[model samples]
Target: MATKTPKNPQKKHDGRRKNLIDNKNLKSPRTGIRKWVYRFFVAIIWFLILLVPVTIYYAHDLPDISEITQPKGGSTVMVMDRSGGLLASYGDVYGDWLEFDDIPAVLVQAVIATEDRRFFDHGGFDIRGFMRAMIKNITTGRMVEGGSTISQQLAKNLFLSADKTLKRKIQELLFSAWLEMNFSKEEILTYYFNRVYFGSGAYGIDAAARIFFGHNARELSLIEAAMLAGVLKGPALYSPLRDLERSYRRMGDVLDNMVEAGFIQKSVAEKTKAENVQIVDKQTGGDERYFSDWIVERAASLIGRVNEPVIIYTTLMPDIQDKANKALQRIMDQEALTHKASQAALVSLDMDGGVRAMVGGTDYTVSQYNRAAQAQRQPGSAFKLFIYLAAFERGLSPDDVMRDSPVILKGWQPKNYSGEYLGQVTLREAFVRSLNTVAVKLAERINRKNVIEMARRLGLTTPIVAE
Candidate 1:
């Protein structure tokens, strides 16, 4: 056994060489796997490169088409009446719904100059704008404002969700490009006029026109138009109805912008501001806060939430909302004075089911609990709205007869409210009186379930339990 080892010393080298050759053969397959991995990564990088610019283009360029559909209720021209008292004070509602024609050229010029001078030139994403903005920001040592075009802002409002992420930016760019290709500049401007919010639940230029100047978009003078245009810079701060000083300052800026953009001469801007403005007092602007609240809630259904920055255009009657507000406030004041634990609510709904007004409480500062829209209460005799409406819907005319007498109802004897029993009375009289016994008798006669269903169909969200 010991003598056999010396003959195969070279054989040992031969076996080692064979092992190295086998390892080299396996390395080729490994190299192929590495190549495939590299190709996959390269494809993803290319996609991101193409996607970022395109996505940004679309999200920043397109108009929100969904908002242009006449909102929930009311027409555009309901705001033409304003003298002595508001149109809404006597139950006449005023709301403006502006399209392109309602806007002033001066207002448009001012916005274009102040916000994005190159808005007409850029294809959604403006490289020159980006570069200039970057340079300016770098030199200033902070980001003052983004050079986002109106189209981009519109795109963000319409399609792109306001999430600060690279993916969203890509979507925005892509959509912007498509928008620029599909829509004309005038079309884009039209959508922008109707979709942008102007504080106080004013969705479009039309709504803003009615609220601020007591007129339609068609009636805005140069100065009145400038005031509205100024609001675009800061709605809550420069709302002409809220802060006159801030509004005047913003109007001046708008005038300056118009002058710079060559839409107006310097003298014209000065003349417009001095002679044309008619600022209404904030206190007398009328109260449509309840209507605003209604729109805010419904707008969440349209976009996502009010906080999401999704654009909303609604057809709420400003006058009706104001009326509801005053009436509700009056009732709440009376209730509070009479009872310490009392809180009142009022709601005004249009024929089309658009909630015109919904006041939850008198004290918004004390609590934001919306009593009208959110609270569930035992409404007492006020609950008769369901019974009366139910009867009317069933073809029961006001002249229809329903016997009103003491009726023993399921261990609970329902009686006349005043303890005076009329031998026979019309259901109308009983409803007007809000008699509990008549309602109970009718509940016994008609399908209680059907009446309940009717109440529900009529937009009563409260739970109806038959006793």
Candidate 2:
């Protein structure tokens, strides 16, 4: 009774004890919620104030809707051999412009399924898809999934660069919204198919079809469509010409996506996979491609900046190019390793000096340097051709004998290539044997200046210093 009386004294003194709730000091839940909401609305207002001017600044540069039908002042140069067959392409590839109705339904389905399954349902951005991608990227510790819809991709490709910046991303979103507002889904898809870049320097579905399958875009098979669709992720990484196995693997994934999206039956997907799609053989040309590249380099000078589609008729002979490529590759493959040579080049010209065939290197993909034209190597014994020609022109016959011994010219002793010298050899023997000592002796007899003059006259444009 005494303990209860002492504890209850303070409690009984006031109207309420300062226990769980103090009316004077405690905050009201209603008031707190109102304050938070007010701050949130104020923050939203500030965000709008900041976003409006930036949006206007970026949106001002957006291309007109009509301009999207074609690349802005861009065109492709179609390089062809003498037979009018496609050798290679240069500049911005436009390909054959395709309409929505002309494109294959399967190809469209493939693109939609693989790129954005909710393309028809979304406005411009896919919020749920973005959230999912965010979660997946965070959990996976890498960006394996992208939330960009087909509209977003089109917007980025058309209006903005591929730079991974916040400003670029905001511009992309705004442009995507603009694109969604301006065109129908079908029109967007048509623009996408006609403008997107595929691998092996191919742009647009038509170029992809022709380059990869050697067919028109309208004729893309089920497997072919899947492969083409897969290329949208990364053109070079998934290109059939770049990596066949990786390309097929991505193609299979696209097929699976198509089946899951109800665009194609599982059985059909399976059948397509089992049937094995036929990709264009990458080994069709080795050196002719170099010649094609050479033509491509000079094409702009020949035709000017390619702002429109142009067909360049080149001086390439496919058959001769193939032979030249094989010969160079054979020498590189058979003799290069044995002789410790890293590369080789071959240039075969027609009687009239038309570049019939040219091999830049053992593998054009590995090294694009055209040794026949671009390389500046000491010709070594090959320079002897000039000296011997000078000697021959100076009344020296092929049967004229020259001492095959080592000789010193101002402390520079020329040695034979074989490191051994014959006592006396004919001029023809020295020329055939590539005898360096004999070559130097012949150069001395021909008075070196004449040899350099003869080389200059024979189209040797490089500076020659007489030392």
Count of clashes, each model: 23, 0
Inter-residue clash pairs, candidate 2: none
TM-score of each: 0.45, 0.54
Reference-based lDDT, each prediction: 0.66, 0.81
lDDT of 1 by residue, 1-467 (tens): 45555678899999987788689555434367788998899999999999777655645644454553445332221122222222322111335555566667766777787677788888888887778878899899777446677777777656666677776666666666666787887777877777776755576777778767766777777777777877876564577654566788888887787788788899987777677466443443233443444445454444442322233344555576567768877766677666774666777666776565566666554433456765667777866777677767777778878777788856888676698777678887888887788887776666687678877886777556764
Relative to the unseen true structure, what is the C-alpha lDDT of residue 145 in candidate 2, on a scale of 0 to 100? Answer: 82
Model 1, residue 322: C-alpha shift (Å): 23
| Per-residue alpha-carbon lDDT of candidate 2 for residues 395-426, written as tens digits (9 for 90 to 100) | 99999999899799999997876799897989
Native-referenced Cα lDDT, model 1: 0.66
Candidate 2: residue 420 lDDT (0-100): 95
